[model samples]
Target: MSILTQSAAFIARSCARLLAQDCLLCAADSRSSLLCTACADDLPRLPADYCPRCALPTPAGEVCGRCLRQAPHYDAA
Candidate 1:
């Protein structure tokens, strides 16, 4: 690998080792994965069933009456 890339990798590794914490989801460089345990378990994950337009939770995979009428403009690609 290139010298600059190697140096950057080394620096990242050193930083992670200096700040290892159980609650903190970190690796030898950056976040271990998408969501840490504390965040994953504590934070609410958006359910599969949600309003497509409003991006709000829904039970039957259909937009709520309010959204259907007013329409939420937050749906995205």
Candidate 2:
């Protein structure tokens, strides 16, 4: 990208960072990130036992039944 474009993008991002102090979800005051700490903590997270390839939640570390029966499109995730 051109230097002018890069500078404009940087300035825009800086302005957005300055202006985006409220959480997007609850409109609560956020320190740095888009979401407040409470909202961030409340977000749904994938289980630690999820399949590495398809990211499907598994009881154990082994591949999920579906993936074991039929491999996913991607070789590695």
Candidate 3:
């Protein structure tokens, strides 16, 4: 590797070590991202069935009733 690349990597590692990145929610060690793997996995995820127009959770994979009656301003969600 080039000298500049090596130097930059060293500096980054030093900074990371000094800063000691940790998960905001769990206070676990996080390498680069804000949240750790465990905390990120525990977060609530959106369901597969959702209204495309309004992006609301729905039983069927279709536009919500409200959106159907009154079309949304934008074409896409």
Could you say which candidate leads in lDDT?
A: 3
Candidate 3: list runs displaced more than 4 Å.
58-61, 70-77
Give one digit per residue, the lDDT tens place, for model 1 in 2-72: 99999999988887777544444443233444556556677766789887677678897688677878766
Task: Return the TM-score for each candidate structure.
Answer: 0.48, 0.61, 0.72
- Per-residue C-alpha lDDT of model 2 across residues 1-77, encoded as one tens digit per residue: 99999999999889877877889999998856799999999999988888878888888867888888999999756
lDDT per residue for candidate 3 within 4-74, as digits (tens), equals 99999999999999998899998899978899999999999879998998888989878899999999999
Evaluate all candidate structures by whole-model CA lDDT and list the values in order: 0.67, 0.86, 0.90
**In model 1, where do residues sit more than 4 Å from their true spots?**
1-6, 18-36, 72-77
Whole-model alpha-carbon lDDT for candidate 3: 0.90
Q: TM-score rank, highest first?
A: 3, 2, 1
